[model samples]
Target chain A: MRFGVVVFPGSNCDRDCYHVIKEVMEEPVEYIWHKEKSLSGFDALILPGGFSYGDYLRTGAIARFSPIMPAVMDFAQAGGLVLGICNGFQILLEAGLLPGAMLRNSSLKFICQPVFLKIQRNDTPFSNKFKSMQVVKIPIAHGEGNYYCDPRTLQEMKDNGQILFTYCSADGEETMEYNPNGSLANIAGIMNGKGNVLGMMPHPERYSEDILGGRDGFNIFASMINWLKGVG
Target chain B: MLKANIYVTLKNGVLDPQGEAVKKSLKILDFGQVNQVRIGKFIEVWLESRDQAAAIKELEEMSDKLLANPVIEDYRVEIVEVNQS
Candidate 1:
């Protein structure tokens, strides 16, 4: 499947995502500038992490008004696969493609380290490669990755099985210490009600190779590609 | 010219680690009377409008759509009619 990585002016991880998907994964991938309005010919889109414009009001606050966002919203509404990582996740929250908002990390520091994530469920297109409750080591680097949502919305997401990943211990046990950002309910990632969009704070592209310290994170891409091959 | 000043802040129940850190530093500096500290953003938008009622409605919509995220933030808009000198 063709993949498009949206690149905002301040986006730093767009190259990382492009490298992994194009060179490492050997998939057709292209970078879509934030001002360009077309998303056609791409089966999936990845909003890689970074500080978009106006990191002032909030992480994704100003980036939502970029010229290309409306097209991205339309793509998502049409049931297209969209993966948002780190700051990308924040953009999705601001765009209303996902629930919740990001707050400063509970420690109030920029954390950059590997954290274990548990696949809460594998029913969606994103995590179908991993077993239920499977653990994967991914790196998270952000200061405002703390996820918060109203109680009612949280409950509704729970009921709809929209939560895709949660911070967990190395042994795959759900614990507080492993929650690097103090995210609500230890959530690390979530899908929209339709399950076509995913927003996760951790950077799977950062650890997509065993040579890079781990390969567990590569399964997410594998799963996405496999799902596309099957559905197409 | 009519200007709208908007303030967006985290909801009361949401955690504000950045604000909390500032509070801790203030305590270390021996600022005793301050019980708590919360941080928020203040923005000003200047637009062409003479009608206060219509301006207020438009500014509120602007804040809701772009200036603030409703899920975790509360925003207030104050309109000021600035006289052209």
Candidate 2:
């Protein structure tokens, strides 16, 4: 499958995502410029992490108006696979592709650390390789990743199994002590109701290799490949 | 010419971590009368249109579309200046 990693003005992790797909996964990957309107040949799209547009006004606000966003919205609406990581996740929320908004961390400081995540559901395309309730360690780096949504929307996502990953203890116990950003309900990741788009604050690409301290994130990429193959 | 001063703030029920930090600092200084402190963004936009009504409508659209996030924020716009020139 062909993968396209989007490069917004301030995006710094596009190369990391591209490397993971090309070198680690041995898949064809290309960098999609933010100004490009066409997503013609890509099988899946990735919005990597970084402070896009200098994170001005808001983290992802300015990047949402990029020329490529309308195309992204159309692609997602058509049920194409799209994964957003960190700042990319912020953009997805700003674009209304995923529900909720991101706010400053409760501590009011940038946090960069590995945190345990409890897989809430494995049926979705993003987590299909993980066992139910499995605990995986992945690093989160951001200043404003506190996710929030209305109670009604939260309930609906819960009902639909749209809530994918939640911050948890190494033992897979959900609690505030492990939540680095004080995200709503300790949510680390969520998927759209249609299950095509996923936005998560963790940097899976950063941990896709064992030399980077962990390979727990490799399965996320593998799951996508598996899902795509199944669909095809 | 018209200048619109817009204030964008978190909606009710959303926690303001930055404001909370400021409140803590204020408490350390012992002002004590402060019950709450919420921080928000103030944006000034200059419009070339002299028609106040039309300018206000355009400002509202700008706020709704880009200046403010309607999901978690509320924005108020005021025409602070109407240049006769």
Candidate 3:
């Protein structure tokens, strides 16, 4: 399956995603610039992490208005797989492709460290490779990773199984202390109701290689690739 | 030209960590009367239209579409000045 990694202005993780798809995952991938309007040949899209448009106004706020976003939104609506990481997730939230919004990290600091994420579900295209309630170590670097949604929307997401991964202890316990960003319900990732679009604040590409200190994130890409290949 | 000043503030229920930090600092400075502090954005926009109603409508549309996220923010627009050259 061909993957397209979107490259927005100020996006620094596009190359990392490209490398993971090409070198690590052995998949055909291309970088799509933010000005490009067509997404005809891509089977999947990855909106990689970085401070797009310098995080001005708000994180991902200006980037959502980029020329390529409407096409990305259309691609997602057509049941195409779209994975948004970090600032990419913020863009998805701003574009209304996903529900909720991100707030400044509770500590008001840009946290860059590995944190434990509990796989809330293993049935979706993004997390199918993870065992049920599996805890994976992934690094998050951001100032606005605190996810927030109205109580009603949170309840609806909970009922619809939209929540995919959440911050937790290494032993897989969801507690306030383990909630690194003060995200509501410790949410670190979520999928839309249709399950075609997934957004998470952690950088899976950064840890997809064992040489990078951990390969716990490799399964996320593996899961997506397997699902696309009809193996899952 | 119409100069529009837009104020974007987080919704009442949403938490504001920056404002909370400022409040804490103020409390430490012995400013005991400050009960709450909420930080928001102030943006200035220049519009070519001179019609007040139309400019207000356009500014509202701009706020709804881009300037503020309705999910967590509430915005207000004021046509602060009208300039003619």
Candidate 4:
């Protein structure tokens, strides 16, 4: 699989995501600057986490208007896979590629730590490698990770199984203690209606290697690779 | 000239943690009358065109595309035209 990682002005995770896809997953990876308008050569896209545009005017607000969003939109519309992590998730929300909005953490502080996530749906392209309700450990670092959506849309997501992941205890139990940002329904990640676009607050790239503490996140990237291989 | 006032907020059912924190602070300050508080953003836009329909269309596009995330926030556009002497 040829993965393309989007690099914005303040994207700090571009290299980490590239390293994981290229080295860990052994897939071809390329960097596409935010100013670029085309994504013809890549099969999948990854919007890495970072403080894009310094997180001014709200997280992901400024970066949404970057030049490359049109191409991202096109790629998503074409049924190609796209993953947005952390601020990239916020940008996806701002860009309307995914539902819900990110708000200030319930604790009102920047949280940085390893978090446990429960796989809610394994049918989507992002989580097909895991079984339903499986637990994975990943790091989450953000100030605006609280996810919010309308009641109707929330119901719709639940009915359609669009929710892909949720915060959970290390043992895979759902509890308020595992809710780092107090996200509604303890949501940690979600997929678009078509299930091709995924936005999550956790840093999967940070955990792709065992030396980084764990290799649970590798399953997600590996799932993407398997999906691409199937398509090709 | 046409002006528009836009109010953006988190949709109902979504927790407003910031507003909750502010309400708690107000209570600690002895302002107990505050029953509930919801945080939102108010934006005023000025348009050079006097065509109300055109301005409204542009504003709607702006709101739908960038001014607000429709999934979580609903925006209302109110246009007021300045009377010329």
- What's the lDDT for all of these models? 0.90, 0.93, 0.95, 0.89
Residues B1-85, model 2: lDDT tens digits: 8898999999999999999999999999998998799999999999888988898899999998888988899999899988797
Per-residue CA lDDT of model 4 for A44-129, tens digit only, reads 99999999999985789889999999999999999999999998999998888998788889999899999999998777688778
DockQ of 1: 0.86
Top model by DockQ, which number? Answer: 3
The reply for model 1, stretches above 4 Å from the true place, is none
TM-score of each: 0.95, 0.99, 0.99, 0.88
lDDT of 2: 0.93
Query: What docking tier does model 3 reach?
Result: high
Clashing pairs in 1: none
Candidate 4 wrongly placed segments (more than 4 Å): B1-5, B11-13, B50-57, B76-85
Please say which candidate is ahead in TM-score: 1 or 3. 3
Instruction: Residues A116-159, candidate 3: write the lDDT tens digits.
Output: 99998898899889998999999999999999999999999999
* Chain B TM-score for all candidates, comma-separated: 0.91, 0.96, 0.95, 0.87
Model 4 interface Cα RMSD in Å: 1.9
- Fnat for each predicted structure, in order: 1.00, 0.65, 0.85, 0.70
Give i-RMS (Å) per prediction.
1.0, 0.6, 0.5, 1.9
What does candidate 1's lDDT look like per residue over A1-232, in tens digits?
7999999989999999999999888999999999997779998999999999848578988888899999999999999999999989999999989988988899988999999999998877898889999888899999998899999999999999999999999898877788898899999999999998999999999899878998777888888898888851
Better model by DockQ: candidate 2 vs candidate 3: 3
**Top lDDT model:** 3
| RMSD (CA, Å), each prediction | 1.6, 1.0, 0.8, 2.7
